[model samples]
Target: MTDFWDDEQELKKNLMNVSSTIESTVATAHGFIRPILLDHVQSVGKMLRPALILITSALGEQEVTEDAIRVGSILELIHLASLVHDDIIDSAAKRRGKSTVFAKVGAKQAVLAGDFLLAKALMLTSGKERGMDSRVVSRALSRLCESELEQDAGQGDFFISHHTYLRRIAGKTASLFALSCYAGVALQESEPTRQMLCHRIGYCMGMAFQIQDDILDYAGSSSKLGKHTGNDLKCGIPTLPLIYALKQERENGQTQLHDLLYQASTPLKEKTVKQALILVESLGGVQKAQILAESYKKRAFSDIKRLAHPQVERQLSTLFTKLSTRSV
Candidate 1:
């Protein structure tokens, strides 16, 4: 298997265009919020969603077009907006090693700035080629909001089933990924089967991506992750590793972990937090979560193999493999 990034100068070029488009889009924001948005963009991550859009667009015969770049920009804006809101909700001061929007502007203006991004995304979507693409974006935005609300409601409630955790991530993270893959192919290919296949590939990959992220919360280094390990536990959010660890503890007739978790209050004691982190790791929570994430990665690879485009399949497979093991 050829390395996907090794030879795809074209894909890299498209991604560069997407980044430029994102910057230009943010630059159009009102004066008060424009600079803040620019700052947030400076610390952008891999732009995986936009990359998915461009990659899947290759499923069709057409060369990558401006429409794909434009749509990629729109998807990235929505993602950035969601992150801004998430930082506010998490009361997080840093993201990707930079001050969060909330930290820079406080919650009040941060909320409006996040909204500004969403509105701009919507405005960009309008007056373009409208059809299933637009509808998919709309539905994805709705799912993202609903999932956030659900997660918010479940905070401090560590008793949630792993199924519930999966459902939440399906909406929170997987929906945008599915939208990105579907939108790309839909723009270039009219074949429904191919479009649906790309969407499934994205969905499985996204699930694995998020599960790996949660696992990192327990097993990864704070500096590498650009945030502290066990931050999720501190926020009283029970992710896959913690959830699996709790189950194992219960099976062993142990409640120390449960007792500590149940007693977790806001501003959780540093001592208790450290203890909980130790318990989760010691009880195989991180290992169990790693296994589950690998399962999803395998599923994604299965779907990727089914794509008719061999080069695209190889690229998607390589991408999934890299993401499965990513540390940040």
Candidate 2:
């Protein structure tokens, strides 16, 4: 897929500012941890959350300011921190085709490095010029923690309903998306209605973004995704596609898929994982998840139209389309 920021030069410039801020912030860490933090920051993917902040902040009457850039950088730091923790939890060795902190430094130091990022992010938030609300940041972080706990607790639970799956992702992933959107407008716009609209737009976009990611785990290639396909299955995490597949199997009075999954070990055997992948595709799980993601994309599009700026609306619409249909 084409880079979403390719056609938008100004947004690209602003994103560069966000990147610089991230690097500079990481540079302040203790010498022992600084290189690791900088390594992860260099591999930051897409800067999607920061992009959302920059995009939505344009909806307001004021020009996009340094404050927006700084806030965007802060959110990206939080996102980076979360990825560090996530890699450790999944025991993932690579991310974005680079060695994960967990793989490079091991779990203990990786955990501290991740915490340092969070602490740095929080410290940045206290700056007097910051436009983003501290309460929103804290709440989003809290939701992220709770959702992660839910997902961890639900491991090997292939029986979870689709509703349960949605809720888990809403917290795990969507909360940051929502926060990015709201922070943009809240920093620039005074109208409550517009602020709320941006929040909803972000929430829908985030939900679609995450569902598509889950779908990719079952249907995408490792080279394209920058990680192994079927990694989620190997880790025994029941994402939407697998959840739907199990539901379909139950309807047909078939337990083959369930039995395969149940018998599979953590970091499931490759052969069994292959079998499970085929069963999931044949049962239409990937297609169903795609449909759900498309629905969210459409909802976000509808709201994007409600915004007054034609340029911002088109940019957002293009982003939503690319995100929903992305292969990587």
lDDT of all predictions: 0.84, 0.86
Model 2 regions lying over 4 Å from their true place: 1-4, 127-134
Candidate whose lDDT is highest: 2
In model 1, the runs with Cα more than 4 Å from the true position are 1-7, 127-133
Judge candidate 1 at residue 91 and give its lDDT: 84
Question: Per-candidate TM vs. native?
Answer: 0.95, 0.96
Kindly report which residue pairs in candidate 2 clash with one another: none
lDDT of 1 by residue, 285-304 (tens): 99998898888788888888
